[model samples]
Target chain A: MNATPEQVVELLRQTNFSTLDWAIVVVYLCVSLVIGVWVKQYATDMAAYIGAGRSVGVWLGVATMTGTELGLVTVMYSAQIGFTGGFAAFHIAVIAGLVTFVVGATGFVVAPLRALGVLTIPEFYERRFDRKTRVVGGVLLSVAGVLNMGLFLKMGSIFIVGVTGLSPDSGALTVVMTVLLLLVLAYTVMGGMISVIITDYIQFVLLSFGLLLTVGVAIWRLGWENIFQVVAAEKGAAGFDPLQGEGEFGPEYVLWMLVVGLIGCAVWPTTVARALAMESTQAVRRQFMWSSISFTARFLIPNFFGICAFVFFSTHSTEMRELFLSPLPGGASSAFTPSLYAMPVFLGHLLPTGVLGIVAAAMIAAFMSTHDSYLLCWSSVITQDIIAPLAKSEMTDQRRIFITRLLIVAIGGFLLFWGLFYPLEGDTIWSYMAITGAVYFTGAIPVLVGGLYWKQASTAGAFSALLMGFTALVGLEPVRQTLAKTLAPVMGDSETIAAALSAERCGLAALLLTCVMFVAMSLLFPDTRPDARQRD
Target chain B: MSVWIMIWKVVFVIALSAFAVLAVGATIGGARDVVTLLNKLKQDRSNTKSDQ
Candidate 1:
């Protein structure tokens, strides 16, 4: 039953993607583009363009919300954790669903946000604090948001390469990244959120069918008992338990997942845009409450796929295992993506021919839907919040839309360049995303929670908390290494320094420090504005 | 699997089943809403065209 290495290579070649497969992907892309262009007439103003006129009904909201949030990069990273950490990784998804459900039931942050009907989160800041605070928040948010999206193109391309049997070092990777970016940019630049919502609905349908099919096939092909058996045999208790300190996740790591789970759905702009775009506060609640399932499945399903990959590789012969994890020719381990390629590579062998094409197309849809939403989100924030606020004159709806389109192009350009250049090392792609996003959410969460609930929240407090979030800059490999080198003499060991300032610690530290700063500054310099808490 | 793993397995099942139920119900509910909204949009657009 074990696949020899040659059989693995042969399997990869057999499913090298047929003409029909490419046609399916192309047709999906064309349909999305046509829908985007078609929707432009509906987006007649800034509200229609950026927030879909705040008219999105519940089902449309649920579908689009899932489409935007359950991005291909999300799948890639969740699966990566599954392959690396096994079933213990499922905790992340459980926490995600539970937090989202509690938030919905309690109407914690999102309900009030929906009630305010602000097009963007910073607009709330402008109302609660001041325009200057809004502008500063926008700048920090865009910096973090844009960087957060930077790796998206690279991760998506990696999936395509891994799925379709393209050489990791091939020119094909760059070509795929460019083509996917262009497809997303075309529709996004044309119609904004109107386009995104339509495309996302369609993508939701395709993505759901694809995910369901993949899960069924995986279960049938590799019986449920066998998957757990192999993982257990190869890894023992560590594979099944995240609580085990010796595995990838420790106490700090789990604590960080708790923070990330709360922030990912609750505070992240892309997800919150769905809340802001909904027809009513009630619709927002129902959407989140309904979406709790997809939230859990989003990470749970992909993590399952990744766990399957680990099991598949482990059960196979040694050479088959080496095919994925082995060092590149004339080099150490692969500097690019590394063992993260295992999931799609394993799937390529597992799925039948036409089915493979559908799954790949579905992921492509996911990649585009997410890119479109993110591109629209960050661009709109920069235009309405950062640029428009600082400008001397008010922007017309047409001008605002024009500037937004131009900014989308600029951000897409940066993503392509960043994706090509940034070499991921040491950290899993999921951790990379969490830490980068913490740069924004770590500070933003407290500012939002306090600004909404706390009576004494001052502009000074909000600003200082945002600045404190920069403490998480230690999560960056280069930044961590630089600081470690600088402190090595004092610390007695560079490795110890690296271990001390891990991504989990940095993120936790950032969140705690920012929370403390927000509280302290608000109490120290209480805002005297009578209407500050009430807002516009 | 240990008792801890068994507990987690149960948790995963319950969570996944709950999500499936919610997602399916939402999907049907959401589709109905979409149809209604689209019809309204169409009605408004035609009304504007008639006025013009």
Candidate 2:
């Protein structure tokens, strides 16, 4: 909503999204840079740079893991789900927490991977299969990972736009996206994982306060009972019932949530990097166990904010309410309305000035922590698994660090371009993330599990399984749309068929197909004799 | 369905409480650890300088 001169004066007086918040953001960036400078000298070796010299303790481990996982993009998307899906969105959190807790309790895939002491997931592929498999896995992983991160810049910028009331088409969107990227890349390129860990602890503390304050403001401004009542009234049984058909999450989605929870904590590379960086296997387990709370709270809190935004917009006067309620029926190809901005806009109205500044700073912390860790994680994989293997001679530590830094900047540049140009079309950002991530994790889950556990897992089986995961591309909305039309004669309705191809169903199908391929390939081609590595 | 909702609500309450306790514990524990780590790193840097 455009503020009148009087309204603008009143908003500035009341602490709306303003220059003071930007100052707060700049201060947070400076603090992070100082921390980066302080930590830079320690990252002389690749081991120290990539894995913090495998010395992260329980608390620092939890703090860094939480900071890394709970990105501003995470909050934005979770809030989107909550805004549209109502209380049904809580199921994702419950599933995420429960799965992470289970992994922590059982020392599942992660515990074993840590015991193996691999720097990246593909490094495990090399040990179990062959060097060739590792290189292929690395290439596929980096591509999928980079693609998966493609939308983070845009989604994060949307949160800033919505909250700070920037025009969507304004060049400021590009500027914000670029600035956040440079800040994160600069620190990550300087100190690597060591710098990421130090900054994360600071970010974690700020994030906790900002998180609690937002939820408190949301509840205080809109009564909790009223929030639930409006959802129930507007959405009925589906609003409160995650398992029912009235909402977006039903049994299929819940089943999908189970897969997400498992892969997220166990099979995902970045989170697993934390476990690999820990002091001990037990510490790794304890980290996940302690972090399960942060995982759950991360989703639950933002989701609550989204629901509150929905309620607040429903009651309050603004241009945002109408746009949020607009039916953007063109789907994936359609440009998004301001609905994604609703939660942030609500925060701008609710928070007073200094409090707004603090929350904004906390969010900046969230943004940097996630980006730096991800950039480091992805670039480290490209350096360690992909390029280091290709080089004729053993790579010097300096060269490895140099390559990783260059890759980080390159990736950052790509993200800026992708964020600006990528057409989201019909799918939700969260769903898009799930589908793209499945491109790697779907294949990796079966291969990693089989390699780690099942004695029959072979090089042939691993290659086949990883290749089979490419079929998950069908899960993307555009791909589904194209396929639906191609098969329309048999499918009956193109739109129905397209709509039926949810990311959850597509992922499960990919997992199953890859599992079959792995088992079949391994059994049929039975290694003349099991490799010694396999037996070991 | 109501049973399912009840089950989830109960589970959520338990999970939230458990998570809150763990987060608090980790934060306190981690803060102390971070201080010690930075101090040790500082000592190592100084020792290297002296040896040089």
Best by lDDT: 1
Every model's DockQ = 0.49, 0.48
Docking class of 2: acceptable
Q: Which residue segments of model 2 deviate by more than 4 Å? A: A1-15, A318-320, A328-336, A489-491, A528-536, B1-20, B39-52
lDDT of 2 by residue, A31-123 (tens): 888988678988757888899878888999999999999999899889888898877888899889889999999999999999988899999
State how far residue A219 of model 2 sits from its true place (Å). 1.0
Q: After superposition, how far is residue A431 of candidate 2 from its true place, in Å?
A: 0.5
Q: Residue A146's C-alpha lDDT in candidate 1?
A: 94
User: Can you write out model 1's per-residue Cα lDDT over A327-434, one digit (the tens) per residue?
Assistant: 534342242344577788878878877888889988988898899999999999999999999889988999999999999999999999999888787778887888
Q: Please list the C-alpha lDDT of all candidates, in the order they appear.
A: 0.83, 0.82
lDDT (Cα, tens digit) per residue for candidate 1, span B1-52: 5765676678767766765664565567667766665665566557757988
